[model samples]
Target: MSTTEVLHHHHKHCDELFADAEAAGLHGDWAASAASFARFRDELLAHFATEEQVLFPAFEAATGMTGGPTQMMRFEHAQMRELIEQMEAALDQRGREAFAGAAETLLMLMQQHNMKEENILYPMCNRTLADTVDVAAGLRQRLEEACPVSA
Candidate 1:
C-alpha cells in the first residue's frame, strides 16, 4: 500500500480511539476512559516514533531538505504528548473536570495534527521518497507490532 493509504488507515484507528474515549467519558466509566486514553496515547507515541525514525529520515534524505515537514511534525508530537500526559494525570486522579478539559485539548490537537500529516507530510513523502515501498512496509510492520490488539 502507499504511504498515504497506510496513514489513512491509522487515521481511522485514531478516530475510533477518540470516539471510544468520548463514550467512556460520557458513561462516567473512569476506568475504561483511562484505559482508552492510555491506549490512544501509547499508539500515537509509537506512530510518531515510526514516522520520525523510519519515514521522515527517508523523506529528508530523498528531498535533501532538513527541518521542513519533519520538524513541524516533531513539534506537534511534543504537544500531543504533553496533552496525553495531562489527561493521564487527570485520569489517575479521577478528576472528571480535569480529564474532560485535557480530552478537549487532545481532541483538537490530534485532529489538527492528523490533518497536517495527512494533507501535507504524507503527500510530500509520497512524492519525494524513493524507497516508498520499504518505508510503508516498515511502518506497517511497526504499527502491527506496536498495536496487536485493537482497543
Candidate 2:
C-alpha cells in the first residue's frame, strides 16, 4: 500500500476508537470509556511519532522543504497532545462536561488534520519521496510495533 493508504487506515482506526470512547462516556461507563480513550490516545501518539520521526523527516530530506506541511503537522500534533492531556484529566475527575467539551474540540481538530494530511501532505510525500524511500513500509512497521493488532 501507499503512504496514503497506510496512514488513512490508521486514521480510520483511531476514529473508530474515538467513537467507542465517546459512546462509552455518554453511557456513563467510565471504565470502558477510559480504556477506549487510552487506546485512542496511544494510537494517535504513535501515529504522530511515525510521521514526525520517520515519514516527515524523510520527506523533508528528499524535498528539502523542512518548514512546509510537516512543520504545520508537528504544530497540530502538539495541540492535539495538549487536548489529550485535558481529556485524561477530565477522565480522572469524572468530569463529563469537561471530557465532552475537550473531546468535541479534538474531534474537530482531528478531522481537519486528517483531511489535510490525507489529501495534500500524503500525496505530496508520495510524489516527492516515492522514488527514493520506502516510507509506507517503514510507517507500517513502526505503527505495527507501536500499536499491535488489538481493536
Candidate 3:
C-alpha cells in the first residue's frame, strides 16, 4: 500500500473507535465508553508518533522542508493530545457533558487534520519518501502494535 492508503486506513479505524466511544457515552455506559475512548486515544497517539518519528523525519530529510507541512501537523498533533488529556479527565470525572463537548471539538479538529494530511501531506510524502523510506511499512507496523488483532 502507499503512504496515503496506509494512513487513511488508520484514520478510518480510529474513527470507528471514536464512534463507538461516543455511542457508549450517549447510552450512559460509562465503563464501555471509557474503554472505547481509551482505545481510540491510544491508537490515534500511536499514529501521530509514527508520523512524527518516521514519516516526518524521512520527508523532511528528503525534501529539506522541516518547517512546512510537517511542522503544522506537529502543532495539530499537540492540540489533539491536549484535547485527549482533557477527555480523559472528563471521563475520570464522569462528566458526560464535558466529555461530549471535548469530543465534539476533537472530532472537528481531527476531520480537518485528517483531510489536510491525506490530501496534501501524504501525497507529498508518497512522492518524496516512497522510494527512500518504507513509510507504509512503518505505518502498518506501528498501527498494528497499537491495536493488535485478537485471535
* Cα RMSD for candidates in order: 2.3, 2.1, 1.8
lDDT of 1 by residue, 41-105 (tens): 76677677777888878887887887777888889889988888887887788778887888888
Candidate whose TM-score is highest: 3
Q: lDDT of candidate 3?
A: 0.86
**Model 2 vs. true fold: TM:** 0.90
Candidate 1 residue-wise lDDT at 46 = 69
| Residue pairs in candidate 3 whose N, alpha carbon or C atoms collide under 3 angstroms | none
Kindly give the number of clashing pairs for every candidate. 0, 0, 0
Worst 10-residue lDDT window, candidate 1? 130-139
- Assess each prediction's global lDDT (C-alpha) against the native: 0.77, 0.86, 0.86
Model 1 alpha-carbon miss at residue 4, Å: 3.1
Residue-by-residue lDDT tens digits, candidate 2, 38-146:
8888888888888888889889998899988999999999999999999899899999999999999999999999999999999998887774665566666766776
lDDT of model 3 at residue 137? 75
TM-score of each: 0.86, 0.90, 0.91
TM-score for candidate 3, please give it: 0.91
